[model samples]
Target: MLDFTNASKLKKIEVNYQYDKFSWDHPGSSAQLIRDGKPKDAGMVEAPLNEIDQVIQNAFNQKVMPGAVVSVTRKGITVKEQAYGYAYRYLDDQFTEADQPILMKQDTIFDIASISKIFTTIAAMQLYEKGKFQLDDPVAKYIPEFAENGKENVTIRQLMTHTSGFEQGIELYKMRASREERLKAVLKHSLANPPGSKYTYSDLNMITLGVLVERMTGQRLDEYVKQYITDPLGMKDTMYNPDIYLQPRIAATEYQPWTGRGIVWGQVHDENAWALDGVAGHAGVFSTAHDLTILGQMFLNDGKYGKALILKPSTVKLMEQNMNQAFPGNDHGLGFDLNQGWYMDGLTDVNTIGHTGYTGTSLVISPKNKAIVILLTNRVHPTRNTESINQTRRLVARQAADAIPVAIPGNKNAWFAGYGDQKNAILQAKVNIQKPSVLSFLTWYRMEEGSDIGNVEISLDGTTWNELGFFTGASDQWQEQSYQIPEGTKFIRFRYTTDSTVNERGWYVLQPQIKTDQKNIAPEFTSTDWELRNR
Candidate 1:
């Protein structure tokens, strides 16, 4: 029921947001929740999900990351879970491989960098439900020092949505005199822009939120999270500053000589979080793919896992609602980033929510499909300088999305515009129409509006083409489109063009028929990047 089709323009271009389908309730099977099952048991296609292993292996083969662990679930069923490559590949900054490198396992823990914010946000929500503080209340009310330097008017909601106008970060590792002064340094930092005027993602916002939680609950952030969230959900492998005994199973992060921390392992990766003694709101939670999926399933279950109810169903709805309406494309909820096609990709929708970590970690949940994707990697291992894992995230997410079949009208085969970004692709067939005729076909698409677009065109001589109609956003359903073919038309084609950026669930066309005065003709297609697919 979340529709942005008529919402205001996104930056320079207009967007019409729509979903392929709609479902208010959890779209899951009637089986046990979060249990291991085959893809089809959850109404998912197995082949697409099977492709995930090769994708992760390719990342390892290319050395994009040292290791990775992935988990996928649909309709409350865990369909895929696997590990790849090495957890501790390098020994130093010179890319020295460890003599005894630890191979990754399904239980190998990872430094899930910024994902800690979601846990902090959930804890804060619990306190909010307990009437500890109102969201609109100024931070100055609870932490008096926050009122300094133009921050008195900043509300809790603004901080949660990253609109407090705080700078991204100040590098507390270099700025702080001691670990004791870190909080003081953060409290005294000045605003970069007037709050409520801009949406700048800043670690300061979540750090401050962590401090607020500690102040209200009279417990450390890690202690509070373990007691309230992790412990109750039975996420045994998730924690802050993982213990010494767990180091052998933990993945290594970047090697930092500047901070005198060589080959960061068995500890927090973020220098700022380390400055805070490996516990902060923004980072420092180490977890495995299996454990993270439990947390994800909790959200898909409306904040409940089994008998434990972590949040009210209404609260979860509020957490998914977009609060930064003034900033068009930067949609955000209480904690999670919303509708981010950059990483969410095919799973990106008005209701799809997710979060990403700096150390190559991501969690995406689609409420409509009742699906969850967890991709954890030690991409920063040996060094922070490496290839971006954004595409890998998108491809894996798209695989999970493709597994959920769209109901092909009449259950017939359809032409799929193969997924990619920054390309001009065509699916065309030479047609000899001596007289005027009507061409009709069915299409279903959800693309990046104003950027990736699909067009139906015809050419008199198969070279110069004229557009008949175009589509950019979601079609909502399989829509039948008809156009009049001219007498001299020689080529009928569907051309799809995309910008160099995020890709969505690509276009699908089915059952093309041309009706003349005599009879209906079925045309054969020669495509550049289209596939004949059965949805």
Candidate 2:
């Protein structure tokens, strides 16, 4: 039998490398301005990024969406930009068009749908920075009519965070005929819950925000976004509605007959946004993948892009801070979703933030790693009843995350705790001790907050163990940790538990040592699903 705890007679543990070299730059915090560069120039691995092409091809093969455009940027470099499949493939819900469908191009424009909310948010923040209004100020203060329907107490922050009492939405396309009447219906809509009492996602919040922006700036939402956002950033291809001449480059969307629209193409797919002249706060922005990467890079750069200061850095920080702490699992910043792993996948951390559009669009920004990942598709083309593209979203995000390697210490392999939802992995070792000692190790982790957990435990009897320390969220870099070993301790272990939900990049451990006043001890560990490999 091998001595589980021996100081000098034990063999040295060996490790293996899976890559050329491990990078130590991630989950990093350096923000670089967006520019064009190759994947290797950004310290990203090309093999994993190459896998992204096949994922998109598989989605196209399965008809998950008629087409898709993807963009990935790291360290301010545009590493990957590609397009796949058809931009317009169907004539109606049940039949393909008889004509040669337009092929997807790198510059193809997409109906970004709910991603428009971020634009509205940026426009509102501009006014707020100009001292036009405060976040805590009630919407009624600017748009006085919004005070109707028991919403007098709903503040601008409540609306941005979706904690206001407003209902999800009203049937503007069905209940109203004109834009003015639809606006009235929204202003007078009733509450579904009390203000600040719960977090309920509702388009009424963004709709109200759109009206507020217009009321404050005396310009329509489209004009304000164009002048303050798209124009300043040189996003010529991004807009609320494309002109007739630009229809050739736009993607087709749902075929709607209820609103007297047939084979909806080159226009906003959202019926409510269409009723509102394709400029509502909740939906109706259109842009190509390259244009959105610029917008995302601006946010990652903290409100500045290539000499244009679109928003104050302070305001950007405020927007990045999670405002919906009262509600767990639904973390929301001012207007962006924070650390949502459903779509963010391994890219998710406490500070990783992004949003998804109903039209098969998702954008993830990792400020820590200074990276941006954008995936756009028109799954609603021809119909809205197609299969969900959520799995593809998570897969692409994970691949982008894998492209950024985690630097291993001394360029050696470390023990990796496997990753998956509902995981319960443990690495335990027996210790022989009669007096006090110290246990120390180096570790790095990025786990789903409040769901995945890593714990260090010690036991005297083996049947019962006491937690020495536990960690959640992320350790932006590798850290050295030490704990005093209790007298009579016989075993020590690292137990990582995760709930049945989002799984992130898991825990890594290396150089575990037990020390006494007189000598050093090496441990022989038994692990469940843990392996030694350089990631």
Q: Pick the candidate with the highest TM-score.
A: 1
Q: After superposition, how far is residue 493 of candidate 1 from its true place, in Å?
A: 0.5
Residue-wise lDDT of candidate 2 within 105-196, one digit each (tens)?
98999999999999999999999999999999988888888888799989999999999987778789877467878987898887899999
* Minimal lDDT window, size 10, model 2: 15-24
- Kindly list the per-residue Cα lDDT of model 1 for residues 356-470, writing each as its tens digit: 9999999999987788999999999998888889888988998988888877866778899888788788999899989878788878888988899999888888778888778
Candidates in order have lDDT scores of 0.86, 0.84
The total of clashing pairs for model 1 equals 0
- Per-residue error at 335 for model 1, in Å? 1.1
Q: Which stretches of candidate 2 lie over 4 Å from their true place?
A: 1-33, 95-98, 423-440, 454-471, 481-497, 512-531
Off by over 4 Å in 1: 1-32, 175-180
Best by the lDDT measure: 1
